[model samples]
Target: MGQGQQEQVATSLAGAVSEEISASLAPVDAELERRYPGDPGTRQPVHTVYVPGDAFAVDTIRSWGEKALTALDTHAPDAASFAAVLGLSDELAEPVHARVRAKLEHEPIEDLRVDFEDGYGPRPDVEEDETAARAARLIAEAYQNGTAAPYMGIRMKCMEAAVRDRGIRTLDVFLTGLMVAGGLPEGLVLTLPKVTYAEQVTAFARLLEAFEKTHGLDSGRLGFEIQIETSQSILATDGTATVARMIQAAEGRATGLHYGTFDYSACLGVSAAYQASDHPAADHAKAIMQVAAAGTGVRVSDGSTNVLPIGPTAKVHDAWRLHYGLTRRALARAYYQGWDMHPGHLPTRYAAVFAFYREGFEQAADRLARYANRAGGDVMDEPATAKALSGYLLRGLDCGALDIGEVARLTGLTRADLEGYAAPRRGDLTASTK
Candidate 1:
């Protein structure tokens, strides 16, 4: 109870804290430099890949959208699915955007997005205050909530010849609506649909860079997500490092690479009747994404599980649904965060996230504190001290158990190890391949 005793305890704890924080940090930096050798920011699988729900739900139309979305939620390959709910034109409904907005605000959407292409209806210029206000309302609602509002994104019409074949134009206006009316919410990641070539991404990024400058937003702050719908993006390019090459083409602007499964399978002449979520084409598409993200900052996400667990079998299918959710680890292995199509996938999303953090942060904290106390420069000894700590750093990363900064702070694992550690080395590859 005495002041002297209290002072000694406080001083002792503070010294311990100092020692702990110091020990792990030094080797963490050295290890990172040894492995990566360059910019850590540019490492593979940059952020988590966020999958939007609109591609699947939009076909059901805004009226039946919710029911369809809930079904996808139940059986999606992973948890935390991204959904695209667009704002309707003034002519369609007075506050047409409200329905879509409600789905995003209410549903378990990971990324809230909209379709802003001209044929998607409404020119950026003609929209009056009411339409703008409705659009703004949705954006504001998402932002104010801790939800990743819009994260601010727009899915522009496809640049692929296939989309043009459908007679869609006025793509330019989509960019304008997002920049001008949507007010370009911060941390915005644009979804460029049906990209057939790397040039499309470069062009779009350039357009965004111009807009960002004009609006006084930081140049290059706006990032991108690629829709792997076109056949060319998947096959035929820079063969081995297809994804890496694709990312290179993005000029470091690509944040995530998503599988447009339905369209992708369709592009390969796979019929909807025969096409299931596990089709070979879909598998190839995801494989490419994983390879591309290797050692990069980009994140790759698996596509949706098409079987909707909606009917009486929903109970029986829950097991399979949970099993399928493990695809999130596959994406995590690639260091990608979001996936396309399937808001129902949110559960798996959180599952992957929680599993990683559960051990990563806590274990990493303990290691760093221990290292700090020793005061010796040799943080890496052997058996108990070095390997045990390194095991946590490596295993935590491989299993999506820890993030880059955490291991980077402690055992000297490079950001690459943290980035590459999404899928820990598995002894049983045969059973684990999703």
Candidate 2:
């Protein structure tokens, strides 16, 4: 063909074919949008600190911070000493240590749950009722006075037949108390523990819906974390992934799926000595949970270690190493959050989190900057990788692992720009690139 002559384009399909295909799959498109809405782009707390319901007080947050700081002061007095204990790199030692201490002094507990289940055990009806009400009052006041953790609420009993009524009552009293105390706080969180079946999740969602109706609150205003404790929660008798069904049963109100380390291990008959977040059994369960939650709004949290940092200096150091190592391992595996059972665990928790983000800060920022600028680099990153990169930096900033000024300097993107990159659905991100 001559250069000036246009080539004839040939197509067999009708012009309406694309429209017809889209119309045929409209419902599926809607379903995909509804079910896999992607990350909410909210600040996910680094760790959840669970205090027994009866033990929770208005000052619990401050108390935990003080205790953690005291633990740091007594165990590792200086940045170099603390870094030595955790074996942090020479470059990261000073910054990570300083940031960890600053985090403890400022925002020690990110998310807190007043445990009404295993930690509280079985209590008298009236006593339990009073405790639940008190928790609400204290939590309400904490939020009112700006002393509350970023997220706070109760972890009620399971939907099992055994304690179903009690669990319902506690949740009712707590939520009602919050309402009576002047409405729910923005950071309210709830956990439905020991869920073994999807039906239990459905029941919990229904219960929350009823609560919203009763309070005249907006529909779907209440969301809770589903605690996966039983082996049956991971795998049903029918050999399907029960946890996936549970997420669907939540009806878009499931914010997280938290692993219950000890309970899950016990359910699987793992010996106590071998039950841990990094155990093969634990990893398998979490891997399934991660896949189930991926692209969905739900997040997965790792279970806690029972090793408390206490006793002699040497013993505390050993425990710190264990907790720090577990936290770092979890971070690497994309489990951004876990449970901190003891105040003593706080120091090591921040240390591990800060180190993880700091160690990778420059690389992530560079890749994200390159992607944002469309500048070619050694590692070619697509939008999906850009999403991950921006997400990593945002998480680091949220948890105080990296400073805004530094991130801005390196990435040449403001917080808003990072959010723009990180907040979209994965499908949207890739589609836009295409």
Candidate 3:
């Protein structure tokens, strides 16, 4: 062939190859987008405190937090001192402690889950209804008194076949009581644990829709979170990851996916003594949850450390230390939210979260600020990095760890910009930069 003709043929072949590649990859891209659309823009609480249904009262929860704070103070008078005892450097300790104090003073409980499953198991129907009524009354009262937690909800029993009827009945009674009293609290959520099938999630969503219509409440007002307890929830009968299918089944009401540490480990035949949040089984579940919930905007939380902060008065700090280690591990894994079973878990919960935020504060803030200002000349801030930075600032602000002024100072963005960055936005940080 002539040289010019050879060049022309090569160019045409390259174009054809490119087209073929694009066509081949389109389905894979579509499937990925379908599974993980990204960030649902939900408010994720750092910890869920599951108080028993029969005994849940806003005041009581508040009292428990207060007591935990007092216990913390007794162990370590201030954040710096606490850090010293924990072997944390002052740089890390001071900021976390400051945030901890602020959190305790203002909003200690980010999410309060009045438990009906394991926490308050198998109460008589009348008694359960009464407890539901009492919870509704307390929630209404707290709202009026301005003492309610920022996020509050109930943890209904599992929707598995065995307890499906009882679970729905309790939910009905609870919602009915809540409606009669006043209305559902703002940010109210329902937690359906041990979800093993997608059908269960769809049925529960319908139930919520029906309750809204029956009680004249706003449609889609209620959202739910699911617990990845059993292996069945993660692995379908087809032996493929079912996380995406379960989320799809929620039909847009899935706020979060919580890893049930102990239950998950147990399902793997891990002994009770060996069961823990950091187990491989639990980590696998968390990975499945992260991948499935990613790009979908759903919050993912780790399970709690069962090692309660309880012992002789003199040795109580020992348990606190253990819980702190577990909390730190969960934070390191990027599971910002977890379950808190006891009142005493509060101190470690705040301490670990604050510490995690503090550890990355300087880098995240500086990079984000530079990126926002378009000053990171050689340092490119990718979309993923911006999302992470924005999320860090959002969690700090939402949990009272950082305020508007601090966020602006650190990120070079105003409160409005920070709020906008809490979720996905049309423009980049440069659009919101000062």
Candidate 4:
């Protein structure tokens, strides 16, 4: 329940570092390699990626879109002029085929959401189901004809009326008409936007469950991911584990979890002011989530950086990428994957992903040398070995070297064997032997 062993840990770490300093001959990296032995590593990656985003989210139509994507890759702020925000048509419907077709053909776009096509809103707005039906017809026409082609995904309206009274439930008939008119799904995420607790997750699960049964839908545990963007969800210690338990409650029907950085920061009174992706407060929130869901099966990811850097110089562009990388790496260290709210941010998405996995593995490899005593048998105490091994194993999972089920499959001794038998030294031909 206590995700952190900090008071216990900080003291032990201080002691260990002191001891290591006193014993100057040992290479912190090498000394541990030899003292503890681990078995051969057959570790495969558990995370598919550490960064992801929407291909054609609203930001793309703006003049700064391209630069924004680059900024996401790095962390640089845009120094150039950005296009003014345009609402309505950008948020609402279009003028049928020629318009949609030209938008796809000439412009750089990848996907579109069928927003409010099927009407299911207030007594006045209950026609959202009809809107969904209309959108379905439009989408099917495009797919059948081949002019406007994109993998469509729609964000559903919130289920609660108190929330609905304030805002609109955008997509009412997506799932209802999904199999009927729109064909099958590429992927479905019931993007529960402002959930603050596990019970909200359970509520969503119940709805999905009952819906599937009533509709005779075959997928038993319909997977849906949660968005932890509320102050309540991120701040409460119970909030984090509650997410894992929610997924379990659904009997393994969870896709992924996303950090709603801006909304969460807003909920905490941090800001709707800064870019959502790279804020320091957001970083702390992400860290807490990571520790909370240490062994859960769900894949968690950091949210997107909101400020679109609209500049020209390559230097400025790369700087944006740098920030994106730092934020991404930090999150990856916490063991989260995926991001949202933009598509032009691909290069950043791809780059951060590699950096996280690579750096995490490299750091662990360096630490393993210390933990296992350089693959030799010289300088490790049992207690130090245990702590070191625990950090290594946990970090490996954080770095995505293992998953929850895999963690349970092996004993600590097995881990010790896989890590290294003793402190491994340079040119040690017998190193990695259990």
Candidate 5:
């Protein structure tokens, strides 16, 4: 048959089986509905600093941010020193030096995570509950006194068979203690590391539900992040992508999926010395995660660089240079969130972030101005592009890259306009321009 005739015949036949097919596929449709990934959040922190849980204290985290500032002021006090630490060419650094300095001075750490996994490796059983208690007390105190970061959380051990008991016990104790002592704060996330299966995530969700009910909290008050640290998390035995399944299994409590660079690389048999965030295998896995989580409200984060900023001597300029490059690579991939291992990593983190946002500030501002004026000469300023430009400026403003006056001059919008801004309204653009 001719192609058109064949298609017409197929369509006619399809109508005959449509009702039966729909009935037969009802179960499949239900599965798909169950597997739907939820929304991706509007904003995500740029970095999550990991402090070993055993050694965790709110005062210490606060102090680390303070110490990072002092270190920046002491070591990279001037533009020359700042340029040297980040290894920026004098010409490249000259423009952003002031912005970097201001960011370091104001907000050194964007997020902090108290890690109980690798960072707190195999503590004594007795010590675990005490540590959990301490963490709970400090968490409550930070909330009351306003000493915490904008985002903070605790990374429990993996949910695999090996550490499942320890992991759940630690979480239960920490949470029970947190509630009894005072209350959990907003923006708190529980980190479940080394997730290898969807069942584990579903179980964690159940745990969150139980915790909520027991503590008289909201149903989804206790959200958690899953770590994509193993090959199994990226692909299943049947060779299908497991990320979607993992997100489905979270049942709406999964806040983000974090990449554990060293563990993920080691799982792929990458050499210890060569394992890095930009590894091809790591990149592939993160790309899969990005695709799976795209528009699903589940944020995707890149893994950390294993290299520490500490050395035998106190000289850290070289170390900061390395850290900055690593962070820059993550930013290049659009993975704003990553793991921070040391206090020294703080300066380089902000330096790289501000540099990334500042580099495109001028172009974005000009594009947004023209687009907002409803004049897109030689530039395709669709609603999507305008929204992206507004988002860039919003993030820049949040990170202290540009202040209110700079935003007004660049985009011709007041702070309030941008704060509740979604996209350029069709009518607003037409009416104002007309």
Candidate 6:
């Protein structure tokens, strides 16, 4: 067609959509906005370290860091030795090892939970109350003194009939203590364990609502991780996915859905000897949790391994290899977080995390840089791919895996630029040309 004809055709096509169609679909657009809000674009801790409530103390964080360092000193005293144990590549060994050591010295534990559930077991009401209050005091002091982890809170007992009342009382004591101390810290986190039904999640949300009302805080001020530790939590008796319902039931108060490796595996009748996070049963449950949490601002975390890296050097090496392999495997599967049950697990955790990001750092940065500049490359990139690339680097930066200077140098984009690309509004992601 002639240029004049083409110009006329383009003008005619500009307003082809009817007002009736847009008006009819308005509610659907609102529903879509409400339902899938995408990621919150905040820092997600790579692991949550659990300590029994009664066992928690002011020195717990430092103690864990010290113990992890001690383990490194005893088992693998040098980078080469540690790399040999984990079979890290020559290119990654020195940098990954140095970063792991620095991370251990500075921020060994990212997220910590003072466990009142299985780890604490059942305690006398009076003793539990005192312990709960003590935990609050210590945690508050830690934050005040600038010695706290990035995230810290309690894992209260589940809402099961046998322990529901105790759990409520403990949470009340803890939060009330925090309020009395100096108001809640921004780093506070909570975990609700062994949830099986959506109604239980609703009940938990209601409990939080009541607390907020009592404290004069804004509604939805509290959010907790829902622990998926039962088979029923994955698949209801009626065959619908109960985890999805649980997320919705949280009423915008769900921060994460954390898999419970042992509890979940045992619920499926997996033998104790065979129970592990990488087990088929555990994978299935976590996969469902991941899908349910996608685009809901709720993160998914994998469960922990019971194996402790202690005793003889040979035994500890074996345990380190196991932990390192599992951590790498989880990262590969996009399960960026997990649970750490011991101080010894810290070394391997950082090592695996650092290696994962560093190995792919150049490729991710190059692709994102290309997309940012809109430069043509061998690969055809889209906005979604760019978002993923930016997210990967952002996560790496958040967890000490990548430095901001290096990221900026490679991508030629600042942190604010990365955040804009990583967390664009729903429709903005796809509205731009490749």
Give the alpha carbon lDDT tens digit for every residue of 1-434 in model 3. 76656453334365789889989999987875666666765567889888898778667656876877887778777877778655667677777777777777678788888888988988788888788777767876777688888777788888888778888888887777777777777767789998888998899999999988887777878889988899998999898888788888887788889988888898889999889887777888899899888767678898887877676644667777777888888877788898888777787788877777767776878887876677865567765577778888777777766667766777778766755555554345235333
Instruction: State the C-alpha lDDT per candidate.
Output: 0.49, 0.94, 0.79, 0.46, 0.78, 0.93
Query: Model 3 — which ten-residue stretch has the worst lDDT?
Result: 425-434
Candidate ordering by lDDT (highest first): 2, 6, 3, 5, 1, 4
Worst 10 residues of 4 by lDDT: 79-88
After superposing candidate 6, which stretches have Cα over 4 Å from the reference? Answer: 1-6, 10-17, 432-434
Please, what are the lDDT tens digits per residue for candidate 1 over residues 1-434?
Answer: 76657543334366778778878697985654443232233322212223222232222222233544454444432222221111112332222123323443353343545554322543343442233333444454455554443244455556556454221223344344555554556645566777777777777677667766877877667678787776788766555544555677776677777776677887889988766445777767778777666445565655545544345534425633442354534534443344433333333343444444443455554554454344344343322343234444554454343456755566454644433432323222123211
Error of 6 at 397 (Å): 0.7
Candidate 4 RMSD to the correct structure:
16.2
lDDT string, candidate 5, 240-286, tens digits: 99988998899888889999898889999999888988789988999
Predicted candidate 2 versus true structure: per-residue lDDT over 80-195, tens digit per residue: 89999999988998998899889988999999999999999999999999999999999999999888899999999889899999999999999999999999999999999999
What are the TM-scores, per candidate, against the unseen true structure? 0.54, 0.97, 0.87, 0.51, 0.84, 0.97
Q: Candidate 3, residue 359: CA error in Å?
A: 2.3
The better candidate by TM-score, 1 or 2, is 2
lDDT of 4: 0.46
